[model samples]
Target: MSDPTDAADLTIEQLAAEVGMTVRNIRAHQSRGLLDPPEVRGRTGYYGRAHVDRLRLIRDMQADGLNLAAIQKLVGSGGEEFVGFRRALATPFETGGAQIVAGAEVRRLLGVEDIDEATITRAGRLGLFRPLGEDRYEVTSPRLLTAAAEVGAIGLRPEVGLDVLEKLDRHAQAIAKIFVELFLAEIWKPFQRAGMPPEDWPRVRDALERLRPLAGEALLGMFEPAMTVAVEKAAERVVERIARDAEKGR
Candidate 1:
């Protein structure tokens, strides 16, 4: 295999071709300050593996629903500290908590003769199963799948479970937005205003990495009590309806 470091020799045109991007797009990124300027040798600029990697990283983040401004914050001045921060963030939050299972097997587990396309689409939206091919899927969370299977076994339609998942997804999105705004206001903006001193970049990265688990813990801590209150209120409503029905019968 060719040495990956040899990418440093590529010209702008070659680098753009190698990364499956248009030269115009590469120039656009440079103009937007999303990409660092290439190395200069007298008259010509040469791109490197770092540039290629950064381009790919930007594309991946775009696919993950990040806007260019969010991507800029994530790429973060192209320092080594930023690279480490990106790597840490790239690590799957869910890790080894899921598995790939055949679509037929998933249907069987759910006690369905054949799952409908709408159900599959809903499952995908819920991060339960991502389609791998015609009949294969990556189960994103086994625990979630188990809960769904239990609901199915208890005679609940998949639609009912999917409805609950839709509500959870909205709530999760709102919570994420709140936390990101907090981080931007309290942490990132202050650092930016101070010119993001190089010595402090590592600390900033560390703060972000530390926030991941803490954020997860905080969300769960808040969710449990909220869930308890919701369930209690629902149960109370059920009891009130039953009492009213008994009075009517009398």
Candidate 2:
């Protein structure tokens, strides 16, 4: 089987070559109705450029943990149009009850200042992030920079570390925004006063004090998987787009 010489007119041999299959194997697929016959260009059974594209898609689906039979059902059975819809049906883990993790605690754990406290302190003053306590500062706000600084490679300087944190600050904000909204919505319901005197607000407050942590517990179940899958799917889509671009230039 020859590789695709041009995108517009493809041969069975070319399709097999692009996808690393033999002509006999490709013919078998055609007999099984897994692939439609390409428009005849002459005496040859020509496959459209679309055939190559579909094969590539099936390869990717397999990598995503789908079996060959499932991939056939999806694309061969003309369910390609529903690919995105099927993806949307996936169960994303719910992420909830995320207590505002103090960035300072993360920094302390990552040892962001071990390389250069003086510089780190200076960066902090430059709005790196302040601690929530009387004398403490969190490695908050610019999360990206904090991460870089903490993971500073063996020779990475404090300045470079701060730069990483600055980058994170940008990306993390969008993620945090969604998380914050969900958190407050799921965990912060106000209690209705139940036949209590207007002056006795403390009773309601006390009830809420207990309710807060209890409510927080319920959120962990959702947030844990939600965030993980979102990040993964985002990365996968980015790479997939890049690959598509590369294929176009081929």
Candidate 3:
């Protein structure tokens, strides 16, 4: 119904049909304490917008792999707070957005006439790009493509950048797992074991939201010093080899 006033006029059968749910399912949800009982008038129980909203929320939770028992617990604890947690979890962790590029532009950037099938396939596997079936592609990270292009400008093949990216992705996944596991173990488990109190939901949701940027900042902070040390050692080895070659020639 367009108005909340009209929504209260809906019978249980009307509510089920409006929400695309079976009446039996609605009754089952009621029996499981997932749905609130409707207002009774004379011989009829009239459902309202709140019931419709709850059913929709339950449907969405089920779609996200939460069972009825979990949904009931979450709803009984406080549906709104759990919803906020879900919304926070669904938010993207990555900062940048993707862009679409023509195949010719991509080739020009990579310094290739025609990208080989294997390289394209490898790029797809790395989530670098998705083919749009008409000489176009959706690049997940334009910055990464630009970096590869810069590598090509220095006379290195794009595959070199992709190789480094593949390795980086592997390490990044491991690092991500560490951060997520840390949050679940240290933050979430304690809250969960405490019966997921209503008041703590906001704190838990806040922690998850705050973790998105913290994880990135922490990774970058750690990586900078490690990268500095690695570069220094690599440069030392290169200089040593060059001097040894010069001495041998003398």
Candidate ranking under TM-score, highest first, comes to 3, 1, 2
Segments of candidate 3 deviating more than 4 angstroms: 5-7, 236-250
Best by lDDT: 3
Evaluated against the true structure, the overall lDDT of model 3 is 0.87
Give me candidate 1's TM-score against the actual structure: 0.64
User: Which tens-of-lDDT digit does each residue in 43-154 have in candidate 3?
Assistant: 8999888988899888877877889988988887867788778878987775778889899998999898998889899988877787888899999877777877897899
Candidate 1 lDDT, 71-184, residue by residue in tens = 787677544555565577677666447788888879866667787788888889888788888788889888778877887889988778778778888988898888778878
Candidate 1 — which pairs collide?
Answer: none
Clashing pairs in 3: none
Please state the error at residue 250 of candidate 2 in Å: 88
State TM-scores per candidate. Answer: 0.64, 0.33, 0.86
Better of 2 and 3 by lDDT: 3
lDDT of each: 0.79, 0.56, 0.87
Q: How many backbone clashes does candidate 3 have?
A: 0
